[model samples]
Target: MQEQSDNKQPLFYEIIGPAVLKERIPLYEVIGTLREYMNIIDRSYLTLTGKDRLSKKEREKYKIIAYEFNPGSLHIDLAIELYEIVQLVFPFMMPAGATGLWDLTKSSYNFVKTVAKLRAGGEDPVIQEDNSIQSYIIGDNNKIMVNPSISINSDKIEESVQKIGSFISPGAVEQVALKDMEEDGISITEEEKRLFNPETTISEDTETIVVKIYRLDIESKKGKLYILEGMEPKDIPFQIIGDQAIGPYIDALKADQLKVNILREMAASLTGKPYLKRVLLVGFPGIKPNQGKLF
Candidate 1:
């Protein structure tokens, strides 16, 4: 691998299997796998920066540059760069460039490693009293701190895991590892792919809760809800069920608070937190349905 600066370390991805034995992998597999890998890094960066979305200019600020491709089972080295954004401390003060690229880089690597461990049925990493998840997977016993609550895009992270799993489904690639410059990283084998499948359970009883609709697709009859009051308020994906016309509940989308009875379906995770799945909306309190507009 090429030598990088002190603050920079080339991230390597090692794909191992019979297909790569000859130092060649299918073009489609390489493209698809690399695409998802970039997505993982992008999402992790967003989480660490505490941003919901990156602007067009900001997207260009963060990038993963591929530098070298080696033999020995198709090893690829990548470097991440985050450009400095200059901001003036005061109107009368000179502009100062702010950069956390080094910290963000290390945290991003630790984030991917933690995700891999979670997918392999590992326990949730220990969260410190300050709410940062500390991991010791980097070179020479380096500790990386990741704050779980900053702005975790769990759905995006899970999607990346599923996509990576699909790429391995064809059996060409038996396993993949995300490693640092020294090749210290986590591996996800074919056998452990099944662990990424979410464990879902449906509740037979109907329950009432207050929630706020974050997004709703009228045609797909699918949406997301943010629980306002309950055990722990969180965003959960929900699909309308039982042929109830969604037209009546269009107002729910604009409402600040909604009281609804629903049948909850939850997906269990190794982290002990059950993800909310399909929610059957049984009743909407205080909203009058327009009979004439029923679809």
Candidate 2:
């Protein structure tokens, strides 16, 4: 929806979740409570015309709303961004639907391909680029909503993380046979191809390797979340807000466990712990996680 010059007041942009049984675990709700404290930010004001002219003093009061780790909250990100354009970033909605920020990384349109959105139920509608910021809900008069459930299909994000890791340390690590890794939307990096060739010097001893990344969304040019060994273990619930959220959480949990163990061995090498058995300092290069002398 494009921003329109109209005679209307700003409304809370509402987001709806999928129609699933068992309340579907509101990503914003946990064991039995809603995390409302982090959900609401202080109010900020902007209009369709004045979006680009926010003074430093005004932006200082911009409210940042944080939702639980829910994929249904995809609209929240846009809501926050759109808030900069219009005074209100959210919209009103009927009860009984899911709301909050959800991950859009695995959504069908996010397959690194040009995706078009068509009319769900209408006589005839012009196809719109699904991921276009031009269609953003800011200043639109019509109802706007997105299904985080819709974006949960693809597994490309996990593969990209794995591939990036592989690029950094080729055959030095093991891989899980994740579904749809070879699918059309997903890509195989050059490092992945080299892994298939036995003669390739995929592994080489190096002094250091980068741990995590600071990646940006290509289209939006927006900063996104980064998963590294250190953070995932401590953030199982929050990590649920990503590509294939549940599955990736489990995978990352496993990885973080190995990271913890490796860090343990490393800790021991520095100075032996009192009760724990000492890890013999073996000057091994290219030691992969779960496959080194820590065992």
Candidate 3:
């Protein structure tokens, strides 16, 4: 690892296989894998900091810089330095001194270790009182605790890991290892790639609910909905399942407060919590039959 001017140590991600024997790597593969790696870090940071989104200043302070590339199977060195302001702005309540910069570093390291465990097809994660996760490392079985919100977005992390795995090839790129400066980390082999697939069971049961559409992408058939009935409202990401026309969703967006009955499809996790996945529009309330049929 290269010497860092700051107190923070540089992290390394090495792509191992015959492809890197020439001390060179493909542009697309490296770039794509790096992007997913960054996403994992960003998601972990958001969960640890308990913030919905990072501000412009916070983004600058928590930014990761890829400074040096080392020989021997293509290693990328990355570094991140957190400021005191970033720690002080924790919106959710955390234990005193838990929001320190070193605490953030430890959290980040634990996040990667947790991902590694999931990739290796470990047991179901232990859900904390705050709905966070507790994961154990593979070899040493070290416990890592993560304090996250109800909307932790574990699906995103799964998606990112799958994306990174997609770049792996049998003879060319066999394994990718994410390690610290001391060379302690997890290695993801090609055969273990399938472990990152999301374990979700589609429910046979369906429910009709009213939700306010916040964002919609007609081409992608995906949108975000805000459920209004609960004591603590939640914004859920959903995909249009069937060949449903986009007209009704567009109308709902324009109407803003229109109540609509949607057949919601949910995915149940190992924790037995049902999460919204897809929706099919069934009926529109307070609208004339002819008007509704027009959509």
Local accuracy of candidate 1 as per-residue lDDT tens digits, 103-142:
3433444464454455344333332212433322222223
Candidate number with the higher TM-score (2 or 3):
3
Query: Model 3: per-residue lDDT, tens digit, 133-152?
Result: 33222333433344443124
lDDT for position 152 in model 3: 43
Top-scoring candidate (lDDT): 1
lDDT of 3: 0.55
Model 3 misplacement above 4 A: 2-7, 88-146, 149-156, 198-295
Rank list by TM-score? 1, 3, 2
* Model 3 quality (TM-score): 0.54
**How far is 177's C-alpha from truth in model 1 (Å)?**
2.4
**Model 2 CA deviation exceeding 4 Å by range:** 1-22, 26-78, 81-202, 207-295
Colliding residue pairs in candidate 1: none
Q: Rank the candidates by lDDT, best first.
A: 1, 3, 2
Q: Which parts of model 1 have CA positions greater than 4 angstroms off? A: 4-7, 48-52, 83-156, 184-186, 199-208, 212-257, 260-263, 266-295
TM per prediction: 0.58, 0.17, 0.54
User: Lowest lDDT 10-mer window, candidate 1?
Assistant: 87-96
